[model samples]
Target: MENQSKKVTLFTPVKLGKFELAHRIVLPPLTRMRTVNGFIPNDWMVEYYSQRATKGGFLVTEGTVINETGHGYYGAPGIYTDEQVAGWKKVTAAVHEKGGIIFNQLFHVGRQSHRSLQPNGAEPIGASAIPHEDLVFTQQGWVPAEPNRALETAEVKALVKDYHQAALRAMEAGFDGVELHGANGYLIDQFLQDGTNHRTDAYGGSMENRVRLMIEVLEAMVDVWGSDAVGIRLGPSGTFNSMSDSDPIALFGYAAERLNELDLAYLHLIEPRINGNIEIADGLEPVASMHLRGIFKNKMIAAGGFDQAKAEDILEKGYADMVAFGRHFIANPDLVFRFKNGIPLASYDRETFYGGNEKGYTDYAFYEAYADA
Candidate 1:
């Protein structure tokens, strides 16, 4: 029992870009489809995030699409609309009021969308027209996603501009910073993965060429928010959205080494699993995210399947600077307090994880407050 209690040596301050984090705990981006139609933030979102503003590191909002054409799933937040920006401002304001730092994750789903979510029924856009066999959640139901029309060489430049504009809107909306949503087989990740990006252009083929779009998006965002206020998320081995790559080490290793030069705020990497299922891999192959720790010189945060003991060991071994947990924070809004006091976490109900009223969203009780009530 004594050894178990002393196993975790987790409580330590860390510097995340310009902000000094009080703890090495983070709230990774967890997409909860609770926004209004047209993807605007709402008062419920403000309260939802404010409730999770405990003493852990920082909280990143779920992926908020950059433009209307970038929209892929229904009820996700957006940064392209003035109304959406104003709505997010309320959320950011609430987080700040609670003495917590928050960042808006700018995203675009690309080929992972339906025609109904696009502009004038336009097909989703990707680096290539290769159709993926994944389903997109829509108002009707989960349906096979449409193949995206490949972006013309010139049109790709316009999409980068959308990321830049979204960065500007994030600042105007009172966010501490903007994190580029480059992970989870989204548009940016699609461009980075060789399996999906089979174009014979400057933005494909070789590793440098394949990473051009992501680098360009980073450059564009830096122009608006500066490097200090920007970060990126990468899921090199994530199989979510039916994603696969022949060689993720070659693909992501080259990317991590190259991105070290940017010196962005923090590089968030998702720990890989077999087909999005978090089971121990049978083989001892070096994990995609573990390799990134040495390659990326900036602050690094690791997410997926992180518990207190594991996070403490990883931190002690210098494998990661911070640890992010999504579902844990969802069930225990006062996660930091619970960890400090060694209180049990509230069990999360899977039934209300997605779209719903306040039952599972804002009604989760805090340890101290809920016990008192």
Candidate 2:
């Protein structure tokens, strides 16, 4: 009874734009490299997502690259092809049959790529021609990223069109909506941060310039799906993929204000501690999301190592409208039920997280099965 009472705070239905969620628990976009043939969402991907689609809950698909050149990792899915669209339709159908609302996260990994992953051995594109020193996993193996070339002004506009087209493809694939992957040091993040984007054009340098690409992309996406069906993920002060801003609070605060004016579906902000799956920096009195919550006047979702108790606390305090679970959901398909009933979650295997078969993907036992064992 105590657990049930505590669960009420997190389980209450909330309005997120046009969708009324059954609960505030969100399954965040996790990059599981299970797509077959490098770009198609296969049968395993269908089974994988359907298992985690709890009725009345929200689930965002793994990062689906908008363009072939945007792909950085092996086995990640893409949305630009007709075959990929057909493949995702199966997954979305399965989730919808279970009464789960799913969103496809559109992505582009700017400079976070190797020549092996790019088309025709082309260099990866970014806001500048800077080289990222991080290693990325490819078909060949983990290789160091090559120096990227800055996208020309014409190319930038074309990339925005790519995002717009991807959103339309997501709709055709039967997604409930689309979430732009604007966080985690990806393409949009690369342009937004000063450390990577060193250009003096309209898409770099000043905060407005740095944020232009994302805003323009968002506007393009909104045109396709309407503002009510679009959401954006952001990581303010996130240092993943060697990314950092000159002044994150100022840059992100201004961005949030602009986003608020757009009246998009929601703003998904990853907590500073969970930046790029690594704890890079600390010592900010108030966290990034906390500061942005005061500035952005829209439904906000906060994610980053949040447990049920902490999630409940934040919801009760009105810090965010929803809480997204990542690793917890990875190991526990019925995470909402486990949290509500106080059931022990199954432990996850770290080795089988990325590119694997069914071992760590769909084999995690539910609470009932675990109890029987």
Candidate 1 lDDT, 117-233, residue by residue in tens? 888988889878886799876777568899888888888889989998999999999998889888878899888987788889888888899899999999988898778878899
TM-score of each: 0.93, 0.94
Query: What is candidate 2's lDDT per residue for 124-203, written digit by digit as tens?
Result: 88888876678777977678888889899899999999999999999999998999998888899988889888988899
Q: Which stretches of candidate 2 lie over 4 Å from their true place?
A: 1-8, 278-286, 369-373
Give me the runs in candidate 1 sitting further than 4 Å from their true place. Answer: 1-9, 274-286, 369-373
Q: Residue 50 error for model 1, in Å?
A: 0.2
Indicate which candidate wins on lDDT. Answer: 2
**Which candidate should be chosen as best, given TM-score against the real structure?**
2
User: Model 2: what TM-score?
Assistant: 0.94
